[model samples]
Target: MKSRWLVNLALLLVVAGIVAFLYLKPQEHEETDAVHEVSNLKLADFDRVSIEFPAKAPVVFEKKDGFWYLVQPYAARADQVTVQRIVSIVAAQSHEKLPADDPARFGLDNPRLKIKLNNEEFVFGLYNPVTSEQYVAYKDAVYLLSGLYSETASTQLLEMLDKNPLKPGEEIAGFDFSRLEQWQEVRLQLDKGEDGKWQVSVQNAKPSQDDINEWFDGYWTKIRALSVEPYTPDRRAGYPTFSLKLKDGKQVHFEKLQESPQLILGRPDEGMRYTFPADIGFTMLNPPVGLGK
Candidate 1:
């Protein structure tokens, strides 16, 4: 009788262990199952992005040498933050996924916005009134994603432009004031000497080291334009040219497009036009002069 009782107790303990394991096993799956991926691609995997809206021009961006550039609607440097924000859609997560059969129910039949990351296309549909999450269609599946993704891609093309005329990481080595009228009759050429001191071609134009450094570091290097537009030069018009030499042995040329209400400088090679307030523009075009600050 005692032997029979021991067998029954052992069977009860074994059953409890199996029950506990079964209960804990589903919890592990629940943790992983809760996260549903909308796209398998990461943000870095995308080399190009195309955004389209209803009744408007489509904007396109391409990554080159680890830097993003606006390739369509005109070529110019891209705002890195904005481009990264738009690219983040590929990393979005979905809480629910539905069949693409009833696309009209989710407004996928006539998507409000369409964005393409490389060859993968994502179409934005109507928002869920309860959650405010947007429905996006990719491949044969429809996913509910954050509305921020759609809002980011629906921006004006101008907002996508980098306000700075110069590319990131470009080091200025010198300035060529030969095209623009310099002090007196002397056209100035300024370059960084081997010892890292700024050297001017003409002796009479020597300014204090502090003043020169301030203009180069505190001003020109930190220059930000009020706005930018696609540059289209008129063949009949004469444009004054200015140039900036980079430490990388590349020279960037700029054409003075306007000088009135607002000063406009056009980078012909980049097809970009940078506009600045008259006072600021004057400061950028003219360097500091004299020995005292």
Candidate 2:
């Protein structure tokens, strides 16, 4: 009888052990039966991005030389932080998933915004008024995601480039200034010689001064806009304008605003424009003069 009781107790203990393993075991390695992928992407793998808008052409940004640069419409510098933000938010997991049975219900038939990240594309659809989330179509799958996708969609081309006329770590080897003065062009420029000295030159005159510090004490150590405002330029409109050509073939073409004292800066090649305070504008316009801040 004792032996039989022992066998029954052993079977009960074995059964309890199996039950504990089946019901009480931690699911550390088991995956939940849910998929929340928005893009199924690793943001680091993408080297290029194109943000497309309904009304405007897509702006392409490429990763080159360890930095992001604009490669469409016009070649220019790109803001790394801006690009990273878009990439990060897009690659994140979708907040919620929804049925994609109806195309017209969520604006999938005509997506207003499209973003091409390397091999994948994100098509933005309607907003979920109830959840405050957005609908995005990727491949044939649709997901309800955060509304942050619109942030990248609404970005302007000029917003991608560095606002400063002179990028950090860039030193100008020469600067050529010219403007239409009463239908005649007047040119004044300054060049840095191999000896690392500055020289000033005017129309038909040889370089006379080697010192530029006499202008603003020490402004050439850094040349930047105190602040900038975006403005669209009239490409064909011929008015009195000036050009400050840098060593890298990029030039700042600008003209004084007609109604205001502010100076309008233009990148003719890129068709981008910016405005600067009159005080700062005149300083950049006349390089040989004092520009003390």
lDDT of 1: 0.84
Which parts of model 1 are misplaced by more than 4 Å? 1-33, 54-57, 182-184, 291-293
- Candidate 2 residue pairs that clash: 215-291
lDDT of 2 by residue, 1-293 (tens): 99999999999999999998989877678756575877656768888988888887778889986777788866776777778877775566765676777778899888878888886787788998998888888766688777776765577666666666555454566655645452234455666677866765544444325346455334445555533444566657775675555567566555544414776666554445556677766665555522222
- The TM-scores of all predictions, comma-separated, are 0.79, 0.54
The residue ranges of model 2 lying beyond 4 angstroms of the native Cα positions read 1-37, 54-56, 73-76, 99-102, 139-141, 167-169, 173-260, 266-273, 285-293
Query: Against the true structure, candidate 2 has what lDDT?
Result: 0.66
Ten-residue segment with the worst summed lDDT in candidate 2?
284-293
